[model samples]
Target: MARNLSTNTGSQAVGGRRHTVGRLVHYLLASPWRVIVMVLAGMTAVAMIVIGPKVMGEATNVLFEGLLGSMLVKMGAKPGTSKQAVVTYLQSRGQDKFARMIDSMNVQVGVGIDWGRFGTILMFVIGIYLISILVRLVQNFLMTRLVSDAVYTMRRQIEDKLDRLPLQYFDRTPRGEVMSRTTNDIDNISGTLQQILGELLFSVFSIIGAFIMMLTISPLLTLIAFIIIPVMALCAGVILKKTQPQFTRQWIRTGQVNSHVEEMFSGHMVVRAFGHQGKAEEEFEERNQELYQASFKASFFSALVTPMSTFFGNLSFVIVVIIGGVHVLNGSMSLGGLQAFTQYTRQASQPIGQLASMGTMLQSSLASCRRVFDFLDEAEEVPDIEHPDHLGQETGGKVEGHVRFDHVRFSYDPAEPLIKDLSIEAKPGQTIAIVGPTGAGKTTLVNLLMRFYEIQGGRITIDGVDTSRVTRHDLRSHFGMVLQDTWLFDGTVRDNLLYGLDEGQTIPEQTMIDGAKATHVDEFIRKLPQGYDTVLNEDSSELSQGERQLMTICRAFLSDPDILILDEATSSVDTRTELLVQQAMNTLRKGRTSFVIAHRLSTIRDADLILVVNHGSVVEQGTHDQLLERGGAYASLYNSQFTKGEED
Candidate 1:
């Protein structure tokens, strides 16, 4: 369960929270058509929002004027009072400012609350608001599609980049780190875009629309609204500066935490076998604590933006209210106009707050974007040659499998050479047993042959065709490898064995049966509840070690590659199973050029050529019997292995 995708759950993901600019620009540039449509929709919505407040304000004006007229008549003011008469009376009382507001309204005292006119204004206000809602829905829908498409393409690019990267990248990097970048980091990018992009677009337009509305109704109040803008900007700038790095560190820590958890849980059996569970837990706690600190600092600082914006917005609202109220009483502004201005004040301020609050998600999103882009921009494996030699083309498509390493020079680290000036030749169908002590470049030899690492000097050729001249896929296709560490995936037994087949190609049922019977696993397979259909868990937990090794060997047999590279293929099995596997391997090697990296001397006693390797060079080479008779390096290694086995 600890390895269930991530160490953290969905909520835990929330807890952890670029090339940055160039990559984002590129990502957005990838979808110009959708973005253009979204922009258009956004403008339409903002237009409706801007118009709705004004229309509603007019409705307020109609209602207020009708009510005022009815009240004046009730107070025994003259019915059907002339507009000019009303203004002249207010002027005479030194209420000259109030006279202007009355002159602007069509308030005839005898008209008394014109219900038909008020109803018309109310209907228009409703229609205006309904249009705003519809336009916003369209904008929201477009935004959702754009985010989905961007992340979808991002995931695909990451996957392709992984496939093109050199094997050394994987060797040096943690599996969980790679997976975290591909999944959690990409998922984080998706979430941030969804949570932030739509709101960001809407907020920008809202601020613009509201500001325009405020200016149209009252410039003095509009000026007061934006007085708080610089304060909000300065505070947001300070908060954003602190939160960005924390977000970056938080995601990096999340990856580290995931790597530790994945490694421990995937190898939990080994940890238990070695009794190191406490050490694992201690390491995990240390990494987890680091992640918590990073996530907390990021979220804490980002949380400041909201409250800061709210304070400024409220301050702006209060100032606008006091000033606008005076204007209304002075008759320079209508009650309806003041009402609209206040709504616009809040509208503009709220979006500024929203923009500030968005800083948290924006920083988190930028961090994820940079990580993804970094991965995408990694040094890829050297591209395959433009005009590569098809490895078997020189041999009439029936490769002779005469592999030769010609004075090869190589190193894992440039200064620390692992293999130097090594040369060896295997004739067609010859079994060349490579015998060496630990770290004597035995596995390194096979890795070079497979082009896992290219040689710095000299050439490796398969059937006289230089391997470097051919594509890796073409070069490796001729070889079937069964290394000491047998690997199987979560798949059916049948699928595992046939994994090496080309797409849409499958082995004959009879071929599978014969190979299983020859490898002495036929009875074992038949005894299983579902035979080959039985699904395997990680590393084929249901099978014994010997059974798993046999399954891998069986897989190599199914591949029927031209050359076989066996790294003590039967080493995991018991003596009886080893003998049975040896017989099958002997039969398997008859016409196939085999390179056996042998540890046990008995396994290679019948090899056509036995090369004794020590300190990155071949110290002795001969037929197995000749080496023993000559009492050279080969003889010493052979005698030592049997002696060690007997002592054990």
Candidate 2:
């Protein structure tokens, strides 16, 4: 089980690939108020757009009404007004009177215009502008707040889900890709929401309102505007259809880049040791260029939207002018009306152009969202039952470290069993050693002891209680582990030693130093400038392998757990350090149940009982002398290593 969990699985996920804008919107709409605010702000902005032209048209009508009406009256010989003087007055006062009238009307009317029509328009303009800005501000705050909360909540959920998911899930996915989903992909969705609130939503509404206003002002001109919309939509459809795959491919390539970089970085020493620096660099460059090409393709197609939409918009503008000119010649539309129609044509086409531009971003965001949700949807290994029994402190005290495996059968995959029908028991405070060649079930035995993998057809018990009844944390926390690879996080040596140690209870420094001395780590610590305060970089790079192993043994000593599993604990140390670590293990194993799995038979010579495991079953069990007398598998293993050691 341990062997399988440590190995990577290269299986890819299947199904649930296609994602839609509707689905993405559903995630944002998780918080309803935020989406509602965004829609209202958009609608208000659109309303202002439609209303602005109407207000201007009303002011235009007022100017002409005073000029031309007065001109007709003077031509008909009205007493006070003359044509020449009136035309001159119309140039200044007529337009001025209309502007003032519009201003006065704005003060009188509120949201609706007509009573003091101009005043109403002004008030409406002010109201809509303020409301639009306020709504926009609130909408941004809310949308961002929602996305922030969603990202946080979703990331946490995925992490928690990963904790419960079966080990098989990790076998199929790279750790780096999973991390990208939680961090990078979530940020993509967040960026989309920000952009939608800032620009896309309002632009869409403005384009809609502009179309409607053009329709009302001159249906003939409106028809010309409508003709361009289909061409624009068609072009957008074509570009987006082609670009969507490129965007998806780009994100996929990015995941590969992240995975490759992480794998190389984590295994840099091995890469250099194997003389694969050039090969590694070549691999990275290939992946990077793939990403570059994908990005270029996506960007190029997305960029096409702007120019295509602009060309259609300009073509529509020309049609609008030619049609509008014919209307004016027919005496059906005024010069002011034609000017307003041109404004509407430009305003209407702007949003279409904007929406067309966003098609690429939308596809990219959707691709990212799919990857993120896929991680969230991964099946957990062992789900917590809703009504799970709570384990109490009394059970903690009752654990006597008497571990037994009853007819245990296990496998990484269901069809292949790694450990089959294996029965073993270690009485309280007994030392049991498991020995086998590499790829045999030696480590798997300890893995079962730690409950890292569950048995398929048998029960494992600690004392009298089945391991299934307790939480994984509760079960694992009671055991102390020392693996061959001693991983040290970046921190002061003392800080790393104190990690997972009791918080409120103080640990005297003398005890820590004594533990270090027992493991022979004190020799190295004392030579350093800061002693136990010396800081170690990632993986304890400054320390020799022996020194790092010693520090881990010292940590295990401080922990004082009731049960200990040592998997190749002395593999990294030199002869002298091995002897010192052996001494420490001797002291540490006293009055505790210990399971030791090792390739070096010398380390387990003193083990009270030895079990030789091969091909997932115990083939022989006895002490060293007994196994030698029996001349079985254990006898041969001991003879081989013992001969090599003496020859060296």
- Give the 10-residue window scoring lowest on summed lDDT in candidate 1: 10-19
lDDT of each: 0.85, 0.76
lDDT of 1 by residue, 1-648 (tens): 767656556435444332465667667667788888888888888888778778778878878888878876785668888878888887888887778878777788866666787788778877877887888788788888888888888988887897789878889999888888899999998888888887898889989999888888888878888987998899998899799889999999999999998999888999999999999999999999999999999999999898899888889989988999888888788899988888888888888888888877889888888788778988987788999888778566778888898999998898888788999999999999999888999888998898887789999998888989888888888889998998999988899888877679887899998988988878898888899899988867679988999999998988888999999898999988888899999998989999999888888889999988887889889998799889888878777667755734
Top TM-score hit: 1
Per residue, candidate 2 scores C-alpha lDDT tens digits across 1-648 of: 766654433112112333445556666678787778767866876686667766666665555444544444544534344334444444465554433333322121112223365566567667766766776676567667767776667677777877777666776788777777777777887787567545777787887888788777888788877787887898799898788779888888888889899999999999999999999999999999999999999999988988898899899889888888776545477655777888888888877888888767877888888877777667655644454332335564535778888999988777877887899888988889999988898888877776667778889888767777777777777788889878888889998776647567558888888877787778888888788788888866678888887788788888888898898999998887788789889999999999999898889989988989998999999887899889989878878877755835
Candidate 1: the clashing residue pairs are: 18-370
Clashes of 1: 1
